[model samples]
Target: MQMASTPTTGDRFRQLIRSLTGISLPPSKVQMIDQRLRRRVVEYGLPDTEAYLEKLLAGELPQDELPRVIDLITTNTTSFFRESEHFDFLTGHILPDRLAKARAEGRKRFKLWSAASSEGAEAFTAAMVLEEARRKGAGFDYAILGTDISARMLERATAAIYADEQLTTVPRDLVTRYFLRADDPSMAGKARIVPELRARTRFRHLNLMDKSYAVDRDVDVIFLRNVLIYFDATDKEQVVDRLAGHIAKGGYLLVGHAESMIVRHPLLRQVKPTIFQKC
Candidate 1:
């Protein structure tokens, strides 16, 4: 004789999620939603996920709960140089060419933004590569800005620490040069990014769903990889168009290889499958 829960609760949750972050959570994601919110349910001593959802949708939960829920729900899969091709392009074409143009114009800094930066890996990776370029006498200064919506991820990024396993993808030479072994015994398995690299990399909280970003209008490169697949068609286009507005004319935008087809905004022209240039 147990009663079933109201279906409107789940529907409302989906609607609110999309409104807050522009991520479309489909019905197939019920299990994922429950799994992610399970700890919150337990924390609130709810009977089950249905009660938790009802409370959340009914505005019965604390005001601060939604942000925590978002931090849990949003996927944050990033790494140092996750896509090596982009970095290769940076060194081989983007950086050098931009440096030449800057030198000709008497400009001095190269600005790169990791639009979906998760835990500082992408920003620090760019810093490492750019530092190496500087060491080789590239004669240009550079800075990297990493932005993500998750406060938890931004905190970790600002810490600039990564566990040993999290660094396997990084080459040994680069690791030796760019990361320092953690001094604390409790942090034995982790290494922190070197000050020289961390100095030029910064992270901030940003939601791509916002009407405008607080980022620079003339960034030389933007890595908007692996994040567009979660949005529906309309959101995808809007996000791409907004991001394109931040690119310096003739600067490049790189998306995940899987998301290459989504960057068809008229302000950008496809140069490579996953690379676009601002026109």
Candidate 2:
């Protein structure tokens, strides 16, 4: 009988990953991370994960390569107009209601955070809603900030290029209006978002697990979708508490449809389906 290989590099890499990013990985993910990062190790001319881990721990790797390591690990699975119902809610329920209330109170500015904005789709979706409101002559001033831990994903988002597969979720009319043909021959079956839309968004590096986030001011809404799945119970509570602190009084928090913190916390009150109001 053949014996299974020992978990030599696996244990060390797990510690390194968790220490650097606060992302916990299960045993099944060890081989996956190894497969994904082994090429990078070779590219860096490191003999093994132990050597790479040594350099990474010592902060001796090239600055640009560090982001590649993170990019390999961070999940960037997103599409335009994802969670379509939320966009409808923004138009039909949320924005108009927030606008009316804020205007009545003599406040015109609104802030939104796409806390796990992967590849800028959700962020741009919010912008499209705000743009629609603007076209309707609404006197609302807003800023939408898209933040992610993956610098590589953010760069792609900032560029606003999308594969044909990714563009299908985007509305046809909006695509024609907002996206221009790709100029590079290498970029077939792709479209790039026009400069106008890109102007309205700002991307930043943020780790949700980090205690020190710069989003100090209260925000009207936070679209923190599809992110809590990576955390355990304790980390989930910590993340929620930190996120809730940034929500403006009576503002809302939106998580992925699959995520639940209903019995998980006391400060959040469920309003509509998949939407929570911070008390």
Candidate 3:
């Protein structure tokens, strides 16, 4: 019998990534993949990238290894109030408008979803804004749900702890009001989001490429920011369509400022550069 031909390193990596995350890694990103996975390869005692890919592709690796690979590959760069304009719009226009409409309808609760919430910064920042609004006399209750594909990211998000530099964009007064300094000397320069804010937020594992989303249908606003850049056009359209189904009529959907859509959906209208409203 003839021996089977071995797959090339590039082909194996491409197939693994596409099968797991529905993301296509361009040739330019091969170096980035190597950089990210080098440590994992060592940790697993694999001799090189080829050995790591072989174990992963052959299904001989531990069950948890795949999740770790996904976690390592997924980007989790975020900061408190990273895009200040989105939060400003949320507090100044969207929340107030939604509050008035909800009050008129005799509803007292508002829901926000941080669909790609990594490390919880976006969700916690949103909680701070809502709490501040309440202090300014907005008469409505609010809750936030943060979701991500990486369990590792979700773990950090649930912890709600951050280094001082991660919060420079936040106003001093809000930081004083919403965050507590870490007590341990070894943890100096770190702060924890106060329990009150954490109480209004929750984190869960979510993959945008999944066939169906398991979230509430009456969400008032969704911050799906800085995530679509990893997806191709088809995945982007599918995700937008599916998310639109979960949004209440007249609700808002916020994407990254750098992202734009060539084809507009009928139910979603671009109200701002990166902000869409449901019809």
Best by TM-score: 1
Best by lDDT: 1
lDDT of each: 0.90, 0.80, 0.89
- Report clash pairs, candidate 1: none
Model 2, 1-279: lDDT tens digits are 999877555666676667667678888886777777898889888887768767876788877777688789877787777888888877777778777778888888778899999899999888877777787888778888999999888888888888888878877878787778867897889888777778877888898879868984578889988878777677777888888889877787888887854325577788876788777
For residues 16-55, could you state the per-residue lDDT of candidate 1 as single tens digits? 9999998899999999999999999999999998899889
* Candidate 3 lDDT over residue span 1-279, tens digit each: 999888677778787777667677887887888888899889988888778877888887889988988898888999989888999999999998888888888888999999999899999999999999999998889999999999999999999989999889899999899989867996799999999999999999988989999999989999989888888788888888889989888899999977756326899899998899999
Q: Better model by TM-score, 2 or 3?
A: 3
Which residue pairs clash within candidate 2?
Answer: none
Per-model root-mean-square deviation over C-alphas: 3.3, 4.0, 2.9
Q: Is candidate 1 or candidate 3 better by TM-score?
A: 1
Q: Tell me the spans in candidate 3 whose CA falls farther than 4 Å from its real position.
A: 1-7
